[model samples]
Target: MEPLDKEQQLERLYATPPVYEWELIVNPMHFRTKFACLLSLTFTFIGVGIFILLPSLKGLMIASSPIIVGSLMYPWSRYLLNADKRHYYAINKYGMYSTSEQIIPEIAYTIVRRSAWVGCAICVFAAIFIGPIAFVGAGGAALMSFTMTNFRSVPHKSQCLFDGYAKLRNYRENEYSLYTEYYHYGFDLMIPESKLMSIIGVIKQYNDTFEEEFVDLYKDSKFQARPIILEIVR
Candidate 1:
């Protein structure tokens, strides 16, 4: 789907947010997630190899690839392909919040961006020395991104429009995610399919109905002078 423009993004804010709470699970077995992890470990291995064979500025980048990839990419991969742990979350006017259905809620955060750089970083480094390897790595990253985007779950608030990016998909049963704000303190709502259409309609109508009222409030706010009267009551 095409990306939401600013107006649509704002309109989405009008929906009462749905909160999804599930036990945190980063299932690394999914093909796309595993592929991302494989790319990460591969670069880490190459970095280690460079550090062992030719330790220098060039070798340092190869070696540091692990940290860069580990910090930046692994977390992202796990989030995109998180496990379906059983939990409960609720949404209200204040914010989307969750409570742990289990004793421990360990998920920390979800990544919104696919860190393709992790896959290609090594390739670029290799280009400085081994051109062919870079091409292979870049190609793999491009391929991985295709799968990654298919299952990607961008983060949304508890009260978000039910259509577009916030819409839940039960077909795969894996394209939803969550982050631990504290132990069971945040929400990752997975709306039911049966109710999805009605909820979307209700929210859209509410937003549309109030569009003029909210936008034109300032236009009708012109002040009128009147005789001043002051009263004091004790």
Candidate 2:
């Protein structure tokens, strides 16, 4: 059993899953749904700061803040809140994949949707108890949540993976998002900090000895998919 285990581990390490099936574990209830109350408070502070710092742009800031928060924050926040669900995806070396044919997201989406009502109630409560200042702020945040698009990852039956290797992009809440002068077909993803150190190790290995399909893009000169740190800008 030990020998077999070692053999399997080696196989997984070397074998590329070009046309294999992998289940992406996704939480239906994502953390962003929980940001409603917090964002409401933040807007209040920003509003106060703007009013204090530059009174002239109060109207402009007030009008634009919601639009900004709604457009960027709202959609990103949608990714934050989700129910517990698993999405099945198939990826190929050529950058193609397929998802379940279901047109709608998992039932967990409804649960997260309803949770927004609770989020609304929290905002209303915060507005009342926290004072009129907070009330205004909460209203703005709630409005953004409402008017802003709640983007969801709609499952498709099948699709081609955009051709590109996974590039290293480290996103921290504190840092601004970085730009890439060169663009590739693959999407940029945020990896867990814990896994980051290990990723660097893999890249180093590829530099030392070009192997591992996962590391192929990073070393290849044609695409030059070298790692570039990316952060999500708030």
Candidate 3:
């Protein structure tokens, strides 16, 4: 029989009922908890600048543009934080499936268009003072940003099959989340803290090479101080 294609694999994965399921809602004030004062002061200054510098409608809009753009950081950060957005995860012996809120394409398109315009403006400003060479750097920056934004805008469903070699990392700080890696691709599953061991046991049955370790597989400098409670590599 021919090997299943990507779509077929997904359909099979989704059709398989999960043995375990859970939901996670990240802290709504996570950002404010970290940057409350800084963000508040920054927006306050922007508000003052808008009123003081821009007396006319056009000037007001232009001057307030920074605030308008900066304001997006809140909703965008909240979206990234998954604030108040409940994420659901389902897992069975065959694989795991997860879902989260999807982003609106219209909003994504607006952001992309504004980003390109900002890049164009920067290019023109730089070219006026620097030289024609500025276009090269600015154009490259625009292209890279556009590409990254477009790629991220595409919807993605996080899922993985357990029929192959895989790695697992359980962070000590977050007892409710499990991070798994298959090949170079990685995804996270949020499970009840009490059931972590039971879930690990289920995974171990399929891949006996699973073991515990303190080492950080990703070697991320920031996470170096964050202890890993358990790690399994196959």
What TM-score, computed on C-alpha atoms, does each candidate reach? 0.28, 0.30, 0.54
* Angstrom error at residue 13, model 2: 26
lDDT of 1 by residue, 1-234 (tens): 998874565455445464322233232243556656776677556556656875766556445545455444565555433433333444333233433221222333213233443445454655677445434323444345434434332343343332212222222232233222221321233434344454345434433221111122224545421111111110
Residue-wise lDDT of candidate 3 within 1-234, one digit each (tens)?
Answer: 998887888788899888777666534343343454455346546645755765665434333434433454444444432234345677776677777543344666566556646644644555566556443323444343344354344334688776544566554434333334443455565444566677777767666456543444545555332222221210
lDDT of 1 at 133: 40
Superposing every Cα of model 3 onto the true structure, what RMSD results? 8.5
> Highest TM-score among the candidates is held by which one?
3
The sequence of per-residue lDDT tens digits that candidate 2 reaches over residues 130-166 is 4454434346666644532343445544332321223
RMSD (CA, Å), each prediction = 20.3, 14.7, 8.5
On TM-score, the stronger of 2 and 3 is 3
Candidate 3: worst 10 consecutive residues by lDDT?
225-234
The per-residue C-alpha lDDT of model 1 at residue 4 equals 82
Clash count (model 1, backbone only): 6
Task: List the global CA lDDT of all models.
Answer: 0.40, 0.40, 0.52
Give me the candidate number with maximum lDDT.
Answer: 3
